[model samples]
Target: MAKTFKYIILGGGVSAGYAAREFAKQGVKPGELAIISKEAVAPYERPALSKAYLFPECKFVMLLCLLSILGFFISVEFSIKIKISACLARLLNIFTLMSQLDFAAPARLPGFHVCVGSGGERLLPEWYTEKGIELILSTEIVKVDLAAKSLISAGGETFSYQILIVATGSTVIRLTDFGVEGADAKNIFYLREVDDADKLYEAIKAKKNGKAVVVGGGYIGLELSAVLKLNNIDVTMVYPEPWCMPRLFTAGIAEFYEEYYKNKGVNIIKGTVAVGFTSNSDGEVKEVKLKDGRVLEADIVVVGVGGRPQTALVKGQVEEEKGGIKTDAFFKTNLSDVYAVGDVATFPLKLYGELRRVEHVDHSRKSAEQAVKAIKAAEEGRTVEEYDYLPYFYSRSFDLSWQFYGDNVGDTVLFGDNNPASSKPKFGTYWIKDGKVVGVFLEGGTPEENQAIAKVAKVQPPVADVDQLAKEGLSFASKI
Candidate 1:
């Protein structure tokens, strides 16, 4: 018999969707693929959820106050309590709060079907179905019998495959792991899935006139703090690091955001650790206890410590390194005919010359596309070409949208307008290493500069005469 060409994809996130798309692009049809997901909804973008979802729903009190002020002409003493019975009610509340704010609210995003868990972004993996990929939703894979080339699902279904791709994304590390009692309660949540966002939304809705405390100062924590602050919730962000967003930004850059957040009424508590959560007699979280023996009074506590790979089903089938599945440059796992991508897969990066796990959505997309090529090459009896793409990630905070291209490994030439001015446009710095452009960091620079820097990062040009270039008052390329 001819080869069946069966390909089974585990986890219905962006990685799986992209992989499916790549496969379909290469003439792989419907019956040839299968996607298994625990979520009822498809994978969607998540970075904006913390800022967008929590904004209006969490700011019910502020909306009420504004409506009360505006309604002085309509009604003197009418009850105006904002509730979240549906998506529209929540959106109105968000709009109401934004009216009083200086920043415009992000556009409402459509939710997807595979995102069943709380705080799940439900828009990403919709393409899987649109592109004719099969999906098994609301199901979990129990274990993989690699020797038998079959896998058992939670529902006792066994699936045999010629090729299996694990795109299992990471799950947020729990605060309870750090010894917080009752941390498993519905109220205490780490923002990952849409359900988590909904839980936080409902909690903030109930305490419409109360405060929120966010644990951690990383991207998720900072973003959640911004969203809560935007909705007029009194927010205090606690981070163990000296400055927020330590992983992505320099201390000075993080301090800039800290000041900006503080100006927006978001209190940032640096050099602090969250020891545990304090629940009231009603069993609802009332306060967050810090390691400094100080109780931060809060109505809701948001844990944003970060995420670890959600790899349990194919545990023994694949070799793992530091909690991530190990993979070659071509995205192949330890097991023959098996592949992995997204947050769970740690593959070699020939570009940066290191073996690291990338958790960004862009990486997932690129890696998935690359994984397809590897599979196709393997099928054709040709060795797959090594995949080497530089890592890139970007985030928007308040008015600043910063993009970081390439990893900074102590080889960068800092440039651009580093002034903390709201009036002028921000610029960025370029990272040149060994005569090749390696990284770029932007502040409030022009789009042209940003694009030029990215292009230069890919191919670094020799530095020209500075004195003559400076006389023209031109772009960074001219000055350098």
Candidate 2:
């Protein structure tokens, strides 16, 4: 028997989660929409896996004994007993590090589900059930017939849809794709989903205090290395870039992070890459051979080179651009009732007047919502505004965090006190194009400061003096 849905989302990822929410908001009837995903669980906040999810789990309960007027409270930290006055005043000062074993626990399932990532409602499985959206988990769609408006699963099941959303997302690029020797050996990991995150977590436990070699200097590499180091494991990071995060980070910006990671005892071997791997009798990886003829011993290897958009399903059925399905501002493809959003959509970047495929969580959420809103508006013979996105990128490692907005083109002026060794390092960089501030990057920025930078990017006010802007640093952004 062939099942059918009025609206069918092809992938159950971050974009799919957001799209489902938008569909419900637009008054979708029960049993009218379905989300098909290979993951066993509902979509979650994927970024958490590399950061909070990999950190240690902390469990603690507190009974605050205080009055409303006194403004004093005591936590379960009574174990670190001291004078009443001292305990009350010195709490935050002494809270230093909380060892990840105390205080709040690490992120886990249900803690970081989708929608919450964008400060919206947490779309749990129950929420989907209430909305009557089918979560076809653990089912891989092996075949697609766009003209027939149908999808076939590996299990020999067929699903038909009137309006189709191709949100299959991106697949992790592994070393095996390049035919690196021993790439398929055990203990070599590439993370892109909840299952991959779980596998890496288990490896961290099984190889406690073991040596780990992180390949690639990108998001997953930097984050996974920090997680391993936090677990008291020895970490060595290898990348071919002149510095870490060469894609978006300036040399000066990369310098600060490289220094910070080194300060944390992370061995960074830049200008090199893993050429091959060697496994032991049990097929557990033991050593990673680099292109520079350097062989480093490693109990496990984590690769985070990059990802390729999964656009094969709609290969011959749609127009493509920038290696993704081509779409207009409304995320509509050449075919009617078919749309593409998230990492797989190469829609017009209205800000830049060009097509772009952003591979980040922020874009995924916004694009999905825009597509749904456009769909609903069309049904009512209304029109929605084109998606106007402000490029936003962020990452956290150890106690360091950074946020960047807008395009990274033109000349950049680095400013502020960027001393990585300082107790509180604050710094920013501005991209000047045609005497205008087109982009901004800030580390250790507060909420107000981050919003200021985002505004600066969006507005792109003119700058008369590059020197003055550098000297003013974040203040320039605030003024704009």
Candidate 3:
């Protein structure tokens, strides 16, 4: 059967969820919009996968909260509340408050749904139902016939749309791709989706306190290393880069983190790559062999090498640039009634005056929203403003949190107290390009200070003296 919608989102990911929300805001009628997702659940805050999803403690705590809530309701039904002493009453009140707080912490399905990642209201499955939006879960689109404006699902279902959104996002690159020996062995994992996080959780339990080798120096590796250490698993991280997050972090910024990780008992091996792995009789990863002729014992191995854009479905049919689908400022592709957004869309970065693709959650959201707005505006024979995205990226691990804004190019200046051993450490960096501050990175900054840096990045205040600018540090941003 060929089901049809006015608009069909090809992939139900973070971008898909945000796009759906924007469509609703612009007034979507029932049967007008459909989202096809391979995932069993609605779109969720994906960053949680590397952060809280791997930790099973959240699920455990939620169970306790549910039990407490159920008991409270049962007691109320039995009229037991009236007979409680003042001290017992106080205890019950405290329990209620704690349960409420615990209920909010679990990064489970409904708790970390769309819009919640940006601090908006959590859009539950029922929210989609109430909005009259069709959410086709667990249905992967296997074939895309853009010429016919139709898509074929793995289950042989046909979905036709008047307008199509190509938002398949990216697929994780596994070590197996490079023919790394024993990469397919059991207990070797990659964290991308919710299921991957669940598998990691199971491995963490099965190999409690066992050794884990994290391959990759990206955010995923950093986050996994921290969480695995918290679970008492001996973690060793191996990467080819001299510093962690080389794509974004300067040497000084990376130094602070590398030292902090070492302080937290994490063994970091740099300038080396995993050559192969050795598995036990049970086909589980037993050790990791590095290019340096070093062998490290491992019960669980997480590979976060990188990912490739999920653009195969529309390959050769759309314009391509910078390894992603080419799109304009409003995320519109060359084809009529078709648009691309999220990590797959390499749109013009207005702030930089260049074409670039960003694989961050913040851009994913803004791009999705901008595409929807442009679509709606086009229908009304009107036009919308171009997307002027201010690059924003942030990461959280242990007691550390950092935010980066603007471009990370040109001469870099590291400032502030970046001493990893300080009782209270706070630091920042500025990227000066053509004599102007093009980027700012701040760690452990107050909310106001973070906003100040953001403004500085946007305005790009000129800096003549690098040394004096470093001396001024965050104060320069605050004045801006």
lDDT of 3 at 135: 95
Residue-wise C-alpha lDDT for candidate 3, range 68-117, written one tens digit per residue: 77876666667754555744684578587775653434267778999999
Q: What is the clash tally of candidate 2?
A: 1
Better of 1 and 2 by lDDT: 2
Error of 2 at 239 (Å): 0.4
TM-score of 1: 0.80
Q: For candidate 2, lDDT tens digit of each residue in 54-112?
A: 78543322222113112324343434555677655555443332333244556888989
Give the 10-residue window scoring lowest on summed lDDT in candidate 3. 99-108
How many residue pairs clash (N, CA or C atoms closer than 3 angstroms) in each of the candidate models, in the order given?
Answer: 28, 1, 0
Q: Output the better candidate (1/3) by lDDT.
A: 3
Model 1 weakest lDDT span, ten residues long: 112-121
- Stretches of candidate 3 off by over 4 Å are 56-106
Q: Candidate 3, residue 166: CA error in Å? A: 0.9
Report the error of model 2 at residue 101, Å.
7.4
Q: At residue 142, what lDDT does model 2 achieve?
A: 92
Instruction: Report the Cα RMSD per candidate.
Output: 7.8, 4.9, 5.0
lDDT (CA) for every model shown?
0.71, 0.89, 0.90
